[model samples]
Target: MRPISTDLDQALALLQAGELVGIPTETVYGLAADASRPDAVAKIFAMKGRPADHPVIVHIAGRQQLADWAQDIPDAAWKLADAFWPGSLTLILRRKPHVPDAVTGGQDTVGLRAPAHPLTHALLERFGGGLAAPSANQFGHVSPTTAGHVYNEFGDALGLILDGGPCTVGVESTIVGLTDAHPTLLRPGGIPAEAIEAVLGVKLIHHEKPTTAKLRVSGLLDSHYAPRTPLLVGPLAALEAEAYQRFEAGQRVALLHHSQMLQAVCGAECHAMPLNAESYARALYATLREHDGDRFDVLLLEQPPQTAAWLAVNDRVKRAASGWLA
Candidate 1:
């Protein structure tokens, strides 16, 4: 396995030479490559088994460079950037002529964000360009929230993994599309939609369905962020009952719950997840990674609340549970 460390210079050198590196971000670790180099960007898709047409978010050092990649940035985009950049929010806007199609998934618009992670921010400043990055995990799998997670996923496939500890926001960025006249919520993520709305002073249009032919953005897939183990999400009562049934059937169940109502089963592994939204988001992927490593027969996750604060958590749980729903 490639060494994981805090050497930003080594990572920058690798990226400049058209190689891929695992980068730390406040939201999650990313499999990063030079945005301007199609060859480098292609490595990201190939390494992650990601589709060539699925867009990755361009991580910039700061918002000042937004105009360099995206054109016709609306006032709403600027407002949100001012309020949330260097944080967990991504703006999908009109792509400039120079922005590569590989980065934009052959679309005319691109997703861009300025992550608040200090190491990645320093690397971006030194690299002097946008880094096209997707979550540092295999396609349709749970995202990596730590350097160790990234190393476990890619191993020696990546040139380097910048060790920046655990990601503060355990989910992906909140993606908002600004290509249209009005801002639309493409995905709920680290930043709550309600917070963005307060900054923009307008109700953001929520896109309920997955990305269609016209609308293409990251993290809009139906069955993404899944574990190899089958996962089911529902009410606490339902999950507990299902757990008992699975245990009776000679299956070893793993249960992740936010409620204290359910007690541990004799033959099953049980984890009490944080009930608060931020704490829950922070621990979400880590818990999934841990359970995934254990090779449980079934992973039962209790569904989060439907309120705005828990929207991002709910979104992740639903996606992670999608594969077993049928």
Candidate 2:
């Protein structure tokens, strides 16, 4: 097993030596490497088994260094950065000449963000360069929101794990593609679409169709953030019925619900999740990670409200539950 540390200098040393470090952000923990080094960047792909063309986001210290990594950043990009940077929004822009193709996944476009996590931000400032990072887990697996999750995923394979505690947002960054004529939401996450639009004073375009020809960003996979245990999402009544049936069959079942009136059933392990979107987002991954460890035969999640605020959490739960949906 790898050592978990609060030392940023040790992490910087490993990163400078072209090694991988598990670093925490407000959203999720990332497997970070030097973005400027192709060899270092390639290690991230190998470690996560990520496709070469699936782009990772490059984390910078602040918006001041944006021009150093990306080229031709638009006015809209600046506004979004002003509103959402140092938080969980990632801006997709044209890559600079020096950014490695490995970092951009052989595309001319690069994903950039300034994370709000104090340790990661301090690390970026001290490292003095961009760190190409994706969620610290196997490709298409449940993203890690804690350092222990990172250790659980890779064990000793990762050189260092920066123990920054539980992630506040507990999901990946919201990715917005700005290279196109209209700003498009590549992925929904920590920040909501309405919030971004409110800041820009313009409605953002939502990418509805799936295509393989253009610049690809992270967290767009159809069956991502899934746990090893099969999961299903539906109404509380339906889930409770199914859980009882499964339990009667002598199978261990886990049910996650947001309802306060719902009492723990006799046969299955029950966990109540937060009702609000923000609180729910913070607990989503950690709840999944916890239940995943119990070796339950099936996990049932009560579907959340289908509102703009619940978009990000709903996206994650939908993907997580997709594996078991027949």
TM-scores, one per candidate: 0.96, 0.95
List, residue by residue over 28-95, the lDDT tens digit for candidate 1.
99999999999999999999999989999999988899999999989998898899989999999999
Question: Global lDDT for candidate 1?
Answer: 0.89
lDDT of candidate 2 at residue 203, scale 0 to 100: 86
Candidate 1: stretches off by over 4 Å: 323-326
Question: CA shift at 132, candidate 2, in angstroms?
Answer: 0.6
State each model's CA lDDT, in order. Answer: 0.89, 0.88
Clash count, predicted structure 1: 0
Q: After superposition, how far is residue 140 of candidate 2 from its true place, in Å?
A: 1.2
Question: What's the lDDT of the predicted structure labeled candidate 2?
Answer: 0.88
